[model samples]
Target: MSEPVKVAGLTVRPGEKARSVLTIPNFWADGQSLEIPFMVLHGKKLGKTLYVQVAQHGSEIMGLDALRRLINELDPGKMSGTLIYCLPNPLAFREKSRATMFDPKPGGMNRIWPGDPEGSLTERMAHKIWTELVSHADEVVDLHTASRYCPVWVFYEADGVSEKAPSETARRSEEMARLFGAPVLYVETEAYGGRRTLRASCVDNGVPAIVPELGGHAHFDEEAVNIAYRGVKNIMKDLGIINGDAELPKRQVKLKWRADPKVYVSHCDKGGVFIPTVSLGDTVKEGDEVGFIYSPRSFETLEKVKSPQTGYVFTIRENPVVHPGERLVSVPEIIEWLEN
Candidate 1:
């Protein structure tokens, strides 16, 4: 059953749609506080609660556009459950940086989840979100994009270590994944960057979640936005929150392994200007040449990079400037098409 939820000092009743700002006091230590913009669409009928988060990483701007379109597209009057969305970490978003402005580190605010109430800016922000919004979620969809390096794909956290089989979390996450309808789907077992992420936390908290990686990171791609909107809309339909059939694509590929393939990431051995012969969504043989590294001054070939595995070139390092040991490519062995 759906009940009224209190957020940002306002009680949002069922069958109501309200937009409120969750304010943080002394955000900048100059009597200036941060206000996170949020919207709640409480359906008249009872159903599952779906939490949609946008711009958590600041630089992932496609999610912001997707959410905006959702606000205009979905009709709460005919909906069954609640759709709560928020634009968190305004400081990082305003600066157009990946991480929080409080720190100059990588991974951004997403590194910290279920945040510390008495920690840094990101921590405090995360803490409030966890306590106020996230904990009450039944299902979640976090919008993010891969760095210029990783290509667009849908990712879900699954239990890699469980000896018995795929756990309930994995099943729910995978179900959500199939419903999302992306070109390529990556079932990120625990070994992949699943720790300390919001997705991991939600799963640990008994809330199944999925993160859809849009095309790029910096700017808003209308195409990417359209894809995201469809994903979110399909999830809503799947969860019975909205009354509609999920629109499915012609074909979808699942990045899989016969026995959970160990992903081999290729890093630059020598720092130089790198040129890639392959692009995203390309299939390659194990011994095929992928790209080359060149010296900036002479423009001479410094290194020739070849595929280590017969797989799909899912990720390609976009930036030419590379440092030794920096990741340049990620190739995952494509098992087969997900025949549903």
Candidate 2:
């Protein structure tokens, strides 16, 4: 066997057994450290390298739980290639915050991708992770969840492709999405010029990476966990990382856009207690009464919120309290396409 390669102060080896942890220094904090935890499971035989990561943003808890289960259940002895789990930004996790360090102007680590070695705390951490972990992997799965107020759903942002150029990237994305067994796949036609997003950086570097939305923020959902787990197992089987009979999903659903067609943000015209008359995933038509805004003191209905388009509801605000112009609903236009 060949000796492990060291890059950006991280030592990575190809072997039947592997374990390592990298402590990367944050740019903003001189004395503090950001622990990017990881575990490498190499099987007795050589195979492909796959990296799975969770909680790039602090608020997404489902991915973290899913990763925990995967680690506990996965046996390296029967496996093939290396499996690395990268968990960066451990501080936001402890504080139960979605993004950034605690107190005074919180920020998000997800937006700081392909990071600068001498930038802000989040930026520098991103740089170290990309240089040390992401660059070396053959396939990557960056897990995430919705915001604290939104419910669970599956969505991915991938670059568009043309017929002339080899669409290997787009094809890889679709294959991974199918392996994930999610109900939706969203492709971003335009690139968001941010240097810090993990998916964007990966695409720029010719890596086939994907961001999976397993569940909502903060709390753990069992259904979402099961789905994500199965998806991962299927991917491992497809990649030859593990040898076994993986159950492939019977059918696959593809969603072209991330934002739902019927999605309309019901902003509060006046600040008051928001009362939702409809639940998420409910079907409604244009002008249908979805909810009502009430005055906190008088208990009078101030405004009635109605659907703007005909579609299935996907997201509803969890917190009832609202400010002026707060979004209350997200409805996605359901499209059922027959396979050719």
Which one is best on TM-score?
1
lDDT of 2 at 72: 77
TM-score of each: 0.88, 0.81
TM-score of 2: 0.81
Identify the leading candidate in terms of lDDT.
Answer: 1
Q: What is the model-wide C-alpha lDDT for candidate 1? A: 0.77
User: Relative to the unseen true structure, what is the C-alpha lDDT of residue 335 in candidate 2, on a scale of 0 to 100?
Assistant: 57
Whole-model Cα lDDT of every candidate shown, in order = 0.77, 0.66
Model 2: which residue pairs collide? 59-98, 112-196, 113-196
lDDT of each residue in 124-163, candidate 2, tens digit only: 6677778887776877788888655443444444445332
lDDT of 2: 0.66
Q: With candidate 2 superimposed using the best TM-score fit, by how many Å does residue 310's alpha carbon deviate from the native?
A: 3.4
C-alpha displacement of 55 in model 2, angstroms?
Answer: 1.2
